[model samples]
Target: MLRTIFLSLCLSLPVLLPAASFAQQKSWSGTAEPRNEKEWIRAVQLRVNANAVNSFMTNRLAGTGRAKGVAALTVEIASDGQIKAVSIRTSSGSEEVDESLRRGVMALPQMPRFTPDMQGDSIALVIPFALHG
Candidate 1:
């Protein structure tokens, strides 16, 4: 009986792991869906520190005396509030500024928890960053 129980557990481990992973993924994606608009906005707001972002970009792209443009960022955050990807959908014209913006998003300090399962396996959101240098 013990041997049989051990075998059953071993067989179920793989299934259980994937189910958990899938659940996590679903949660992340669900956050941005129409049903969870409030949670989505809160997640986006807490993910990045605007002050830190402004400071980093200003310092990194001080060239030309100033940098002015808008970067459209699509960020993917996991259920546990981990940033998986930060993609720049639209550029600010200046390569330096664009790169800095991406870096800042990637280096976001923490993903604030406004609600449980706010950050699923992945959430895709477009956020605009206005750069005025």
Candidate 2:
């Protein structure tokens, strides 16, 4: 009986796995957007952090020493997940660092799409970044 159950479970995994994967994809692909503004902001932050890490790993970012600073940027993201615009809300005390951050955000190919429940054509986010040398 145990062997039969194990065999049945194994056979069912392939069918179950695809359904799970599709549901996950649908959730992030804009079918099920974040439930609120806070959740949306968190999602955006996560994506930015991930991109920054990837860029740093690839040596695409400026030298660590030069990039070190704290900065805040007001970014406008379209409902479709495009970065519409980026403006520095608080400077990093270095024009180079500020511009670098702005350019990096603008260069992104895409961002998380606005949650379907979110009310607006676009959302503005004040994202803070602190780089350590």
Candidate 3:
């Protein structure tokens, strides 16, 4: 009976290990939670979309872009939501495309700001820009 039980457990171990690792990975991923102050991330996204239209970046992209790949940036924001610094973590391969994205980021106006209780000294964001025809 002891050997039979041990064999059954060993067979199940392989199946359980992948599931355990997946759950662990999902938890560690820095996804946003709908906490009060943290909501600024959403606001920033919306503002970026709106601000993109008719801006200097419009000329840089040349035409309607269909989102080829994603780029990344590390942005430092003060407790007041003012951007302290902007650093590009990953490039979109083309210098023109990367510079266009940079211009768009620099054009963003001061946000509505965050309260003192907000966590984190800064946040890293992934920006996906489309590829033009």
Candidate 4:
């Protein structure tokens, strides 16, 4: 009976072992160091210009006749090349302009990787969109 019990216990061990092994695995691979601000800016620029910068060219809020302003956005790009979240870190002070900026950033494709800086391989991206000069 003892031998039979031991075999049963051994049979269950493999299933239990995998759960423990998986739990010990790390969530992210490849270190995320500080990324170059310039590089991030360039990425944003490329994204904006991919289809021409015309998408954000004008805003007619309440028929005000095309206001001019710049919108700034800060986004955190995960190591997986996904835009984790975006916030209007700075804005052109117009709701229309700000919303447009947010929309443009949201429309960007998922980035896969970024270069590292002193901060250890993490990247913070900022995108600025200008409308009406």
Query: Could you give candidate 3's per-residue lDDT for residues 1-133 as a string of tens digits?
Result: 0000011110110111222222222121233433464455555554444443323235545444522354554445554556566556566565665565566556565654554555555544444333332
TM-score, cand. 4:
0.51
Give per-residue CA lDDT, model 2, range 28-83, as digits (tens).
56434467766666666655554444444345344556556666777787877788
lDDT of 1 by residue, 1-133 (tens): 0000001110110111212222223234433432353644544543343422543435555435446766666666655456678777788787776677677667664353335534334556666655555
Stretches of candidate 3 exceeding 4 Å from the true structure: 1-35, 52-57, 64-67, 130-133
Question: By TM-score, highest first, what's the ranking?
Answer: 2, 1, 3, 4
By summed lDDT, the worst window of 10 consecutive residues in model 3 runs over 1-10
CA shift of 80, model 1, Å: 0.6
Compute each candidate's TM-score over C-alphas. 0.57, 0.61, 0.55, 0.51
Candidate 1 structure lDDT: 0.49
**Best candidate, TM-score:** 2
Predicted structure 3: clash tally? 1
TM-score of 1: 0.57
Clash count for candidate 2 is 0
Write out the backbone clash pairs for model 2: none
